[model samples]
Target: MSSRSVIIDNTDAQVQYSPGWQANGSPNEYKRTTSNTETQGASFTLKFVGTSVAVYGTLDIVTLPNTTYVLDGGNPFPFSGQPQSQIQYQQVFYTSPSLPYGEHTLVGSCVDGGGRVILDYFVVEIPLEIPTNTSLSTPTSAVPTTLGSKPTPPTTAIVGGVLGGLLFLMTILVAYLWYRQFRDPGRRRDTKPSFTSAEQDAQTRPFNAPAMASSSYITTQHDAETPNHYSETPRHRDVISTVERHKSPHVSLQWNQSQQPPSYSM
Candidate 1:
């Protein structure tokens, strides 16, 4: 990021000094060339690479005239010399703003009414180290290392697969149910009950009733006022009736009829 000055001798510039111009100074000196010609077109062009450029020359208010400075084919600017009795060498007459970092040309011309134009040298302000395509070394601590040979699959794909499988199973179950409904519309209504008829009757039967009964007898009398005695009592009769009403084919019942028995002795 440091900057340095590049000095170009006036002898190295492309000088177009017309007749009456003098080249009297030494080539190694700062002000190597001088032109006192009053011609309007006496000029010098210098090419250099830098961010900015300045022209170094002798300025004299009594001898030098107003000079024109043109940069990169742009508009020219007039530089009026200050009133001074003595010639000053290495004086910065004009300087340009920071230009692009590349080659550029600057032109200095003397006006017709000007007295003299001295070409001392040129100064170019440039960076000390110009950047190039060379590669820079990176610290090992700043670089990252590979942790594995292959990258793992994303969790979203695995989750999507599980969800897809569950959806497929649900679709199949729903399709099966729809098919069953279409094939047998009344299957739900016709389904067998969990309990059988015998089991239902047993559940409804009285808890104290006998599950089975042996042979039983009954007698009927024509006289309503007289009471008829049977082998089984009235309570046993009621149990027998209940068993006969709800009896299944597995159980057997026998009945006997007889006239009123002879008067029972107390």
Candidate 2:
């Protein structure tokens, strides 16, 4: 049920009332009404309870030779000038209590040519009202007439500087962590990768890929004189076989001749 309003005219403006300025939804909270006779326009804002339910409005008097004015109520509040004035503009807001719910309505009206009040535009709204507690009104200590007021902006600046410095330090810390994790990954991994004996041997040996393939395709040759050792080519076997074959034939013929001599004696 709290409200705020503004009064406006051609050159002058002022805020008439704001119900949410203090205790919000507390019943003890009350709004201070304002009145402006100046020929200017003004703006007002309202918040119900302590919640964000807010309403704002601007009021301006229509320029006419003579007219009385009255305002309307609903979603956005509406108003009309006296019958003498045909055009007047005003804005208003609406609020409700409980639940985070709200709505807005911009309703207006004007006196028609029939001399009857006619609706120009109207809308409905239901605004949420948050609960609030009334704050105690404590009397402020009187300021010394001689001493000037100190500005709080410098303290705010110092606090801001401290916050900025803390944020910068935090950013640096985060970047360092990221660098350790990604750029210097060994340290971040913590544990070193272990190599088994077989793996280590494989890593140390020179990999002759083509030589290995050739060894597999070619036949293995062995030395006849040293059967335990390996040889490089089939020529080793060929040489040994040729020498054995020639020696065998010569030995057999000598034996045959020796046998024949013995036969003559018989």
Candidate 3:
């Protein structure tokens, strides 16, 4: 689907030069190195892998002569001679015809002994094609499928249940305390003391003692009548007795009684 070119340096090629030929310089330049041979049969050979291959070198018309090139045991083809005084480096010297894509070889020989030839590099063009499936059947091995595990429930529900039970217990305890505070009679303090039946009767009954007349009553009675003939009326004595009882702290009077007054004798 695609094509690309590759450059091979002169150092990568094979050189067979006679003792009379001279070699110089490195492969980084367009004119990597020069080789001069006064002897014929001096040759340069290059082996490469690609669909097409071309040779590159220097051409000097003043001091260089023509050369011959052959491709894969084919017939020799002579390179064109430069008549004018010109010098060129990294020039395409020869290109082979398009051959099948594989390993190929090219060889160059000095046609004239006096000629100078420079070996620089070679350019190879390669065709790239997308690979296709050669087999028709599918693979028999199966790919394993991974199954996901189910998620587990969290512990929050259990913790919440425990907290809810504690809250219910606390609520019941608070309610019980409230009920006890209002309903328990023993917890209340008495503001008034309770009395016994005998104490109540003693407090309610009056002192039963004979009444003593006041000095004013005695004086009034003496002025009214002689001491020996002073007859005390029962109603008058009762009135005096009531007055005296009210004044005395030891006596108790009852106003609800409807009884006959007692008769007094002087």
Per-prediction count of colliding residue pairs?
Answer: 0, 12, 0
How far in Å is the alpha carbon of 56 misplaced in model 3?
1.0
Q: Candidate 1 — number of clashing residue pairs?
A: 0
After TM-score superposition, the amount by which residue 245's alpha carbon in candidate 2 deviates from its true location, in angstroms, is: 15
Better of 2 and 3 by TM-score: 3
Q: How close is candidate 3 to the true structure, as a TM-score?
A: 0.43
Writing each residue's lDDT as its tens digit, candidate 1 over 1-266 gives 55666555555534444454556453333434544445677777776666677776676656766789999999998886787776665577888998756677887787775477766656666665665642332222221212211112236767999999999999999999999889978646656666788798988996664544443533122123335534444455557656665774434554444533334468
Q: Whose TM-score is higher: candidate 1's or candidate 3's?
A: 1
Q: Write candidate 3's Cα lDDT for 2-79 as tens digits.
A: 555665555443434444556664433433455555467778776665667777767666666578999998999888
Candidate 2 deviant stretches above 4 angstroms = 1-154, 186-266
TM-score of each: 0.44, 0.19, 0.43
lDDT of each: 0.61, 0.30, 0.61
Model 1 per-residue lDDT at 209: 47
Runs off by more than 4 Å, candidate 1? 13-20, 26-36, 133-266
TM-score attained by model 1:
0.44
